[model samples]
Target: MTIESESDHILFLSRDLLDDIELQRLEADKLLLKCSRLARLSGTDEIKQWIKLEMEGYNGSKELSDHYMSRTGRWTNFAERKGYWGPLAQIEENIRVQKLRIDVSKVESLSGDGLIGAMRMNRDAQQALANGISSMVAIRSRVLNMLHTFVAGVYYERQFAKVAESTFEQYKKDVDALIAAHAGEVLEKLPSVVARLQEGNDEAVSQALTTCRRIIDSFADAIFPPQAGTYNLGGNDLSLDANKHQNRINVYVAERTDSKSRRTRIRQNLSNLYDRVSTGVHTDVTAEEAFSLFLNVYLFLGEILHLGVAQTKDSVMA
Candidate 1:
């Protein structure tokens, strides 16, 4: 294209004066090599052809010059206003630094540790769900049996305390045995469960607990289940860390709730619920089911409470 601007004309003359025939051939070869590199970088054949044509000085007519001027004007406006680059060295440097900052920020947000943290969180969540569910099943069974025996002993005697006292001792022993056998299993799965709980919503946690309750109730009915008795298992008063004995339980619940000892309080309510369910039933609910039920209850309650708190805060802010 014929250079119109004084500055462009000077640039063109200077370059032409420097271009010997052998140097022109070498420059053409360099352009061809650049075309290949651009094609690989851009992943397009059209850009390669455009580079080839531009390097070969394939101007068809005066109309082509007008067309080139129009395209150049568009690009020049964009480079000057929108910060692209061409022959202007200072403008190119400014664009380079601004682009560098944006690229660095993106990389910083997704470092290696960040990726690993996300992966570990996911793995932990899956493991927790599985273990919590299993524990629920076992706990359900143990609670049911304790309740059945307690009721049987009381129903056949006048002294409720005497009957309850012996039953309570046996209940504690049974619980200890059950914990001995299954506590490690639950603890092993806690890291993941804690992670999963951290991500759960109230509805999801409630649904999971509800599923465990339904499964346990169904299983209990199939075993030493309901009979003609006054079994009160509908109250939600389980105390989680009231006795301060369940440190692991506290940690899991706290992490999930993002609150201090909220999980413990939830566990207490869950325990009460279990006791009520098993109070008069003649069923063989397993310890695993009970633990799972407890976990579910804690998670569900925490989710609901969290949402309520958030809503309250928003309302206050408004």
Candidate 2:
């Protein structure tokens, strides 16, 4: 199916990949191939690149140059473990702990009769096998999540675009000045963020993260200014503070009973992103991570702005 036509039936593809991953029916290479195709259909450019690294390996991907899986050094910790049973069942790493990239296509999987078969031999051959299949599995789950969100976004954007057309002229007249200033400033950041990231240096990474925070900060200020300390919601006073985008964003989302679930999801996504952005400010963040963080600001903003314009529908008509 052509990209446009098959998009209507994307859920089918999503479910197929889900089934494959859940059942462990496909090898990492085949699974990544499927995910890469699925991702190309509806995922963002950045996410598509993330998947590409798995399929093609980080051989020549400049954006992910820092994350190349060249040295699979067992990584920060438990990553060195070959198997997980009972006490070894769980694996945890710090969120800041970066995962080593692997080219799933290259990993040679051990095939035998489960535990009994796997115990039969110890290859101890990382150099020989180059096991990147597990990293491929992570991509499967990620692709599923990104697909769901991207498909939903496509639907939302279409529905909102229709309303936006009918409501645009009137809405602008009422709230253009205040909204435009923040929106314009936010838009202006796109170029600066691009320039900084292209530099591909530590300082550039920091600048990119700072820009991410600025995007959130500007969006928060527009929707829920810190100057407005108390948000009177259903007559309950919820507090707000400067630079505290999460609380302000939650308050913004809470105002909409009809969409609190989706809006809250968006807020939480941004909240998690904000934390990552904050972490990058203090720690070393790759250009890849910084770019992804910046790319996401606009994703949530689309839903937020759609709801935002709806919030002004009555005032505009009045």
Candidate 3:
């Protein structure tokens, strides 16, 4: 048969390349086993003599003839004249052909087996890809959380700072007015009276007053607190009733939209890949195409997973 016809026949017989490999391997192994058994039964000396005769001819050297006679216990003249070499040579040639067939079969089998092994490898790659994707999603969530937490803390701190600054400014104005009003009576006691007046009665007001004093003492503190370094919106407290409720609604809507889009894309890609693989396996595509598809899916999954992991790390840092 033509090479193309043979290949087509093989594809028709087995959809999977692995199945073809396994069958050829099995056939080769059987033939090799048969040959080994035949060799054992025939005896090594007999086999050697057979090989020697096949190498030489019936009218070969006396030395070779004598050696063959001694090993097989058959006189050279009787063996040669009766055409013993002819039958034995044919048997040896058959065995050699069998061995060659076995070897060739095994090579072919292994080629197909390797492809199947590659397919299995792709599965591991796919899993890794999935894991990577999941990890990235997790990382993104974490980054977002940290950012939220930072924002919340900053917001609260800024609000407190504003209140404190306002209170301090008012206190400064009041002290100036009191000093101006009592200027004639207590010129020397102005500082002490201003200090007393600045100290508010209520606990919250007192705290605000203290904070204002600290800000005034250190101008840097008023602009930026030492503890609040960077603003991150992730990992912010989600327990605030109004903020929590609003965020929940937003997250739900976002998740639904993302889920729908992801599903549609994945389904479409899978369908396209499936068609390519199927066509390649049977007719239009070559062995190379089949191999490529397997590799493509494997690589695609891995890339997705890698992206996910990166996103995850970014989220964590955030």
Note each model's CA RMSD in angstroms.
33.6, 18.5, 36.6
TM-score of each: 0.17, 0.41, 0.21
For residues 202-317, write the lDDT of model 1, one tens digit per residue. Answer: 43344434444443333223222233423222243323322322232333344345453555566576556555434413444334443455555434433433444565577799
The candidate maximizing TM-score is 2
Off by over 4 Å in 3: 1-117, 136-140, 178-190, 193-318
Global lDDT for candidate 1?
0.40
Q: What lDDT does the true structure give each of the candidates?
A: 0.40, 0.60, 0.39
How much is the lDDT of residue 136 in candidate 3? 35
The residue ranges of model 2 lying beyond 4 angstroms of the native Cα positions read: 1-182, 232-237, 313-318
Can you list the residue pairs that collide in candidate 2?
none
C-alpha lDDT of candidate 2 relative to the true structure = 0.60
- Using lDDT, rank the candidates from best to worst: 2, 1, 3
Between candidates 1 and 2, the one scoring higher on TM-score is 2
User: lDDT tens digits, residues 39-147, model 2?
Assistant: 6876777767756655554433253433423222212233452321111001212111223322332335655567444433333333333344454334344544554
Clashes of 2: 0
Q: What is the lDDT of residue 247 in candidate 2?
A: 76
